[model samples]
Structures are given as C-alpha cells and as structure tokens.
Target: MLDLDDTLFHESDFARSGFAAVGAHLENRLGVSDFASHCERLLKAGSRGRIFDQALAECGHHPTPDLIEELVDIYRSHKPSIQLPRDTVAFLEHVAGLPTALISDGPARMQRNKVVSLGLDKLIDKIVLTGEWPDGYGKPHPRAYGEVMQWSGRIGSDHVYIADNGSKDFIAPRALGWKTVQILRPGRVHDGVAPTAEHEAEFRIASLDEISLRRVLAGSR
Candidate 1:
C-alpha cells in the first residue's frame, strides 16, 4: 500500500490549502514570484544541495543548515484538513487477512502522522519508509520496492502493488514482476506513454477494496 498524499484522507478545498503558505514563505525570502518553481526544481534535482545554496545566496541570506531545516519544519506545519476515506478503511478491513505493506517517501514524523490518522499502523503488516534507511529514493526506483520485499519476505513477483500514479510508482513495479493496479483518481493521468504490448498486468482496479488476493495472484488473467 503506497500512500497518495494523505492516503485515507483528502484535504477539503485542497487546492488552496498549504500552497500559499510555501509560496508566501518563498516569495518573501527568495524574492521570486514563482517560489513553487524553485521548490519543484529543488525536489526534482534530488534535493540538490548547491541549488538550495544558490537560492539562499540569491536571497542575500547565506545558506545555513538550520535555515533549510526550519524551512522544512514550516512546510510541515502547514496543515491540511485530513478526513479519512471510508473506502480506504473498508479496503483495509477487507484485506485484513492478507500480508500488506505501506511504502511512502517523506519525513518520518509527517508521514507517521498520516499513517496514524488512518490507523494504518494497525492494519498493515509492514511499514516501509524509504527516508528511514540509506536506500531512500522516490517511486519508479526499485530500491523502495526492494525494501518492501525485504520486510514482506516475498519476491517482487509475489506482490501486487496498487497505486494511482502510473509512471512514477507503478511502472517500475510492473517491470519488476509485481502486478499493477492503476487507481484512476482525479488529476492523475497517463503521460501519453502507452503500455508496451508485452506489458500485461494481473488486474486493474479503481479502488483497493475492489481487488481480492485470490483473484490477483491466481493467474486470473
């Protein structure tokens, strides 16, 4: 189980929630109208150290470790209305008998808040956070899957990873021999990269509750 944002929770009026907080913080400090652009670049560049230093230099503020840490703290403090999704809970309850895992990439505390909020800690068999170990990297990287495989004591082919993001998360897992369930949530899109003719999945599901392990692992396709 990979969390999309808050996993079971959806922030009400999510569009305007914490975006402005970060934007305002960056705009004031960086003197850039588009702080989000810089932030995106920072993250996409694998949190490049020098880019952040340059950002600080541009702001006439020397880069300090504390400043960056504070920036992350302020960002995390930006609250979103987290309302647990009933469907997610129902899915977790239904799949209680099967081995399950929650793999996510984010700060330990913040992600832990989300997991606890959803009571997922009690439900999942394993909780794998890439950030907790040296093998930390975002999805589409096999390392995250490797950690999950380690915890579950299962080979990649034995697990079915259901995720909403097709390219970033599902693609590598599919290639690594895990079955994929593409969740069609709003705002999630295929990037016009069609699945290869040779790429076949055991199943595709809209929600976690819709899949049964028997059907998924039985060579049902």
Candidate 2:
C-alpha cells in the first residue's frame, strides 16, 4: 500500500497549485493582487492553520469566516497541477505486478481529484480515502489497512505500506502487523520524528528510489 501527498509527490507542489487557484479567484473576484505569493511566503515561513487568513491580512484584506471558507473550498476543489517525480514513477513501475493500494486521508473530493490528477487510478488496484468513512476511521484507526488486507487477500507480514508521515502513517499499518517503510522525501511537509517506538516505521529510506522491492516483499527490515 501507499500514502498520498508527500509519499508519491511533493505536497508543496499541490499547495502551490491550490494557492495559485485561490489567488486567481481572489484577484478575479475581489481584486486582491498577489494573494498566491503571499500564501506561499507564509507557508515557507513555517506558518500553518492560518495561511489563507494571514495572506489575506498581508494583502490588506480582512478575512471573515465566510471568505476563509470560500477560499478553502476553492483551494480544495481546484484541479491540482502536480506530477510524480521520476523516482516515484520508476518505483511504481518496479512494483507494477504487485497488488498496489493507496490509503489517503482528506476530503473525498480533494483526495479523489489528486488521485485522478496523478493518474494513480490507472496504476493502483485499490484506494481508500478515509474521509469517505465516518469520523475516527482515519489514520491510527487501522480501518483502511484492514480494508486493504481484505482487498489484496494478503495477511500480516505480506503487506507492506510505503508512506511519508511517521506520526500517523505507520501506526495503523504497524499495529496490523503490516511492514511499514517511511520515505523521507525532501520538501515533505511532515518531518517530525515519531513520538514513540510503536509510532515509528520498521524501516526508513530517503526516497522511493531507495526501496528494495525484493526485500520489501520479503518483509525484511
């Protein structure tokens, strides 16, 4: 299985795409200039949870709840301009014969759009978007991993999950007895170390190019 966002592609690319869309909307509708650049600057400065609001403020516009919500909708619904890195493309081809799955957490529309934009639907066999399920079924819940097991008809050690975020990406798969590998790609958004041993992946690599398919299938750490 695999995780979306930083695992398969640079999530910052997606963010920039969304910010561009939002900025275009603001410029076209509200005459807010350079909104996208402001958002990107805020993100580079390590701002989180308030990129839109701060960007609006920086652009001399008061951000109301409705305006923020509108911007978010525009950001999430826009067609993302993103692509898989060459390494990721080669890695997927390397495992082409395997039963591949993608488990991602986000709003269904947004995540689905990403999958389509990345052409992942043509490459992956199964995909689970946690947002399609009820609350509490997201990462650390093990629900999506179980679904993958059922879909692939694979048990415990036979399943390997390649993902990025150690905080939540590895927890459910690890608990389910599936081998986990964390790919710490450059420019990834989540760079925090796991809080505990159980929260960490069994193996770690810098990129998908570093993965060994034979060893991965053998569940060798």
Candidate 3:
C-alpha cells in the first residue's frame, strides 16, 4: 500500500505554496511593513497547508504559479520553524517492513528534494512523483493513482491513500476502490468542503502512529 504526504510527512508543500503566495503578495503590495509580520503569523498559525488560502482571503489577493515557486524556494531554505511530529518517524519505522510507496503531487523537483534531504528514500519502498510521469495528471484525476498501481503491480483495492487536503485531490482513487485515510491535522478549518460519503475508506486517524501498518496489509499476505 502507498501513503500520501501527511501519511508520511508532517507538512504539505503544496499547501505551503498557497501561503507563500500570500506572503509574496503582501511583500509586493504592502511593501515590507506590518503586513509582512501579519502574513508570517497567519502562515505559522495554520498547519502549513491552508495558510495561503487564509492569508489570501485576509489580504484579498489571488495566488499565481510564480508566487508559489518563490514560496517553495523560501520554504526550502527556512524549513526549521516547522516541527515534524514525533509520531511521523516512528510510524515510518513501523511500516518499514512492508512494501510501502510514497506517492505525492506538486513540484517534482521540490518533492524529490524533500525525499532525498528528509531521508525518505531510505525508508519507503518507492517514491512516485506524479509530475515525473508522462501524463502529469495529479491526484483526484485517477491517472496518477492508476499509474502508481500499475507500476507497483498492486490492484486499486489493495492500496490506501492518505492526505490532509481537499477531497477533490483524492476523489478519483476512492472511486477506483482504493482505501482512503484522511489525516486529521489540527487547525485545518473546513470551508464547506466535505469528505465524499461514498467509499470513504476503512478508517481515519489523527496520526500515522495510531494505525497499525501490519494490520492493514495483513490482507495482502
């Protein structure tokens, strides 16, 4: 089975991109004043995933790909402020024995950097970058998930995808009969986006440590 970003990593890089855009917007428009301080606070308070969206709403600015890239560079330079939960490493160790895949979407180079720098390659079975694929259709598109399953020779129903983002990013896999796990990170305020009531996986956990990897894949054996 494969796990999504939050199922393995603590922060969501894509979500941070949104907040980075917010920061860039502030820097561009507000000219490095109190607005910068406010932008930092808003980004820090959130789980690093939805900070940009919240900040954009507050600053009344729209996000662009350029702004997102700038944030990625800044975030890569200064990633110390964010704390990776203790349970994350422990869970990775726990599942190290199983045939696990780390599949993620977003900037391919950036995600690959994270895998190498964070020592993820030493732990997981494989790291699948959607952007590296020919189609480049990200999750919720089904093609990415299909590619992963095909590459791994694992059937759709045998894998579990976990992410702490919107359902649209994952709706396709759920439709294909893969199990889903929504990592309930704190401060993820819902803006009327709801989970798909249909085929909503077998479980939901607040932390990866809460679920037993051995139990989930026992069926495979």
Candidate 4:
C-alpha cells in the first residue's frame, strides 16, 4: 500500500496549485491580485489553518467567515495541477505486478481530484480515501489498513505500507503487524519522524528509488 500527498508527490505542489486556483478566483470575483503568492509566503513562514484569512488580510481585505469559506471551497474543489515525480513513476512500474493500494486521508472530493489528476486510477489496484469513511476512521485507526488486508487477503508482514507523515502513517499499520517504510522525499511536507517509536515506521529510506519488491518482501519475512 501507499500514501498520497508527500509520498507520491510533493504536497506543496498541490498547495501551490490550489492557491493559484483560488487566487484566480479572487482576481476574477474580488479584484485581488497576487493572492496565491501571499498564501505561499504565509505557508513558508509556518502559518497553518488560516493561510487564506491571513493572506486576504495581507492583501488589504477584511476576510469574513463567508469569504474564507468560499475561498476554501474553491481551493479544495479546483482541479489540481500535480504529477508524480519521475522516481515515483519508476517505483510504481517496478511494482506493477504487485497488488498496489493507496490509502490517503483528507477531504474526499479534494483527495479524489488529486488521485484523478495524478492518473493513479490507472496504476493502483485499490485506492482508499479515508475521508469517505465516517469521522474518526482516518489513519491511525486501522480501518483502512484492515480494509486493505481484506481486499488483498494478506495479513501481518505480508503487507507493506509505504508512506510519509510518520506522525500517524505508521501507527495503525505497525500495530496490525504490517511492515512499514517511510520515504523521506525531498521537499516532503512531513518531518518523517514520529513523536514516539510506536508511531514511527519500521524502516526509513530517503527515496522510493531505494525500494524494490524483493528487498521489502525479504525484510518483512
């Protein structure tokens, strides 16, 4: 299995794409210029959860809840301009014969758009967007991982999950006895380190280029 976002592609790329889309919407509807740049600046400065509001403020606009909500909708629903890295494409090809699955967490529509934009439906056998589940069923919950097991009829070390986001990505899979590998792609959003050992992946590599089916299967055994 695999994770989306920074695992297959840079999350920042998606952010920039969404920002541009939202910025274009603002320019068309509210006459705001450079909104995307303002959002990118705020993100680089470590701002989270309120980039839109802060960016609007920086653009000299009094951002109201309604306006912020509208901008967020635009950001999430826009067609993302994102693609898998060359190495990621190679890695997928190397594992083409394996039963591959993608498990991701986020708004369903946004994540679905990303999958389509990345053309993953043609590459992966199963794609699980955890957001489609009821609340509290996202990563670290084991629901998605268990679903993968059921789908592939594999259990324990028979399953290997490759993902970023060490904070929560490994928790459920690790507990389920699945081998986990954390890929620390350059420019990835996650720190690739968990707050505790229990949350960290069993193995870590700097890139997907380092991975191979033989190596992971042997290590899992």
- Best candidate, lDDT: 4
Clashes of each: 0, 0, 2, 0
The RMSD of every model to the true structure, in order and in angstroms, is 6.6, 1.0, 5.6, 1.4
Q: Which candidate number has the best TM-score? A: 2
TM-score comparison, 1 vs 2, better candidate:
2
Candidate 4 global TM-score: 0.96
Candidate 3 minimal-lDDT segment of 10 residues: 75-84
lDDT, candidates in the order shown: 0.60, 0.90, 0.59, 0.90
Over 4 Å off in model 2, which ranges?
219-221
The full ranking of all candidates by TM-score, starting with the best, is 2, 4, 3, 1
Give me candidate 1's TM-score against the actual structure. Answer: 0.62
Tens-digit lDDT track of model 4 for 6-80: 899899999999999999999999999999999998888878899999999999999999999999999999999
Q: Where is model 3 more than 4 Å wrong at Cα?
A: 1-5, 12-37, 44-84, 133-136, 188-195, 214-221
User: Measured by C-alpha RMSD in angstroms, how accurate is candidate 1?
Assistant: 6.6
How far off is residue 26 in model 1, in Å? 13
Question: Can you give the lDDT of residue 125 in candidate 4?
Answer: 99
The residue pairs in collision within model 3 are: 18-52, 19-52
**Per-candidate TM-score against the hidden true structure:** 0.62, 0.97, 0.65, 0.96
